[model samples]
Target: MARVNELKRQLKPGQVYRREDLTPYSNAVDRHLAQLVRDGTLQKLAQGLYYFPKKTAFGTPPPNDETLVRSFLKDKRFLLTSPNSYNTLGVGTTQLYNKRVVYNLKRHEEVTLNGKTFFFHKTPYFPKKATPEFLLVDLVNNLDSLAEEREQILKNILAKAKTMNLAKLEHAVDEYGHSKTKKLFRPVLAEMKKTRHAQ
Candidate 1:
């Protein structure tokens, strides 16, 4: 359990981790992995990623994959800016609303761990990939005002929209069209809707 303890000792909120991170402490992985899940010592966000279990006011309910991933990826390269939030908000959005997370990663791989899955989208094509760390940094740089840079964010998103899966994008906007968040996308979404209609 030393490895698990090391992970418990090191990981902070908002950071995403991989198994290679814990390689030095491999001996304790299996026993502790099973034990952690069993006794609530850890919440596995994916095959190699985990987080300290949450203690909610409701006396500790099971955390979803998103929550676990967010808490574990503490202020690092991987941020929790993904469709997880949209999924949690409801079964509506321009994403799969999939139970797992979808991140814009510097790499590409699919991981299934502790019953949770994560898909890492490559970095080269995303113009407005909003991994929360990058988003927060950009937000901070721009007067800490999300409003000040609203147009830029919207435009960047549309520019990169072509890179995403077209069908899923349509389903998301169609299902969640009435949300106020749509207001941010009104201009681009309108244009997209027009183009979609013409086709």
Candidate 2:
């Protein structure tokens, strides 16, 4: 009991922890974890994942998506994004999606952590954060998977692209665009350049 109390003292609220992380603090790590869960000191997010929820006026908020994924992956290099973010580009993507997408180097499977669905995509590279340029490129990369009309969205995307920083958009295309996405953007970029030079 004294050792368990000692272990509990090490936990910080609003943080996620893996069973292995708690092991060094307790000789009977599994037993202490079970006790903590039973006493509401920790919430089991998954088989080995736990969260010490922070209290708020409304209620205890769920763990931050980034924190949850970081604990689960044991890596901080990942991009958390959703199709819904594309709507902010003003390219007519208004359909709300229930899915959350995580682009990382480690996993490629659908997982549910603490009632939220996450699609873990293993990719060669991804930005540390999702910028507008990255989101635009990503929108095209995952176009087929989205519920929006692809043709209309593509047209709107090109129109929207014209209004953004040409260099950043081109860089995002080169760095993150898939083969088809590259093919789609090449001519549009060329045309934009020609128009700019003509002006």
Query: Which candidate number maximizes TM-score?
Result: 2
- Residue-level lDDT of model 1, residues 1-199, one tens digit each, is 5667775676554334555665566576666666766786666666566555456666755555555544344323443444334323221223343444344445466655455566654443232345322332222232222223455544455565544445555444443333444454446556766787899
lDDT (Cα atoms) of all candidates against the true structure: 0.48, 0.93
- Model 1: lDDT of residue 71: 37
The all-Cα superposition gives candidate 1 an RMSD in Å to the true structure of 13.4
Tens-digit per-residue lDDT, 109-165, candidate 2 = 999999999999999779988999999999999999888988999999998888888
Models 1 onward score TM values of 0.38, 0.96
Displacement of residue 42 (Cα, Å) in model 2 is: 0.6
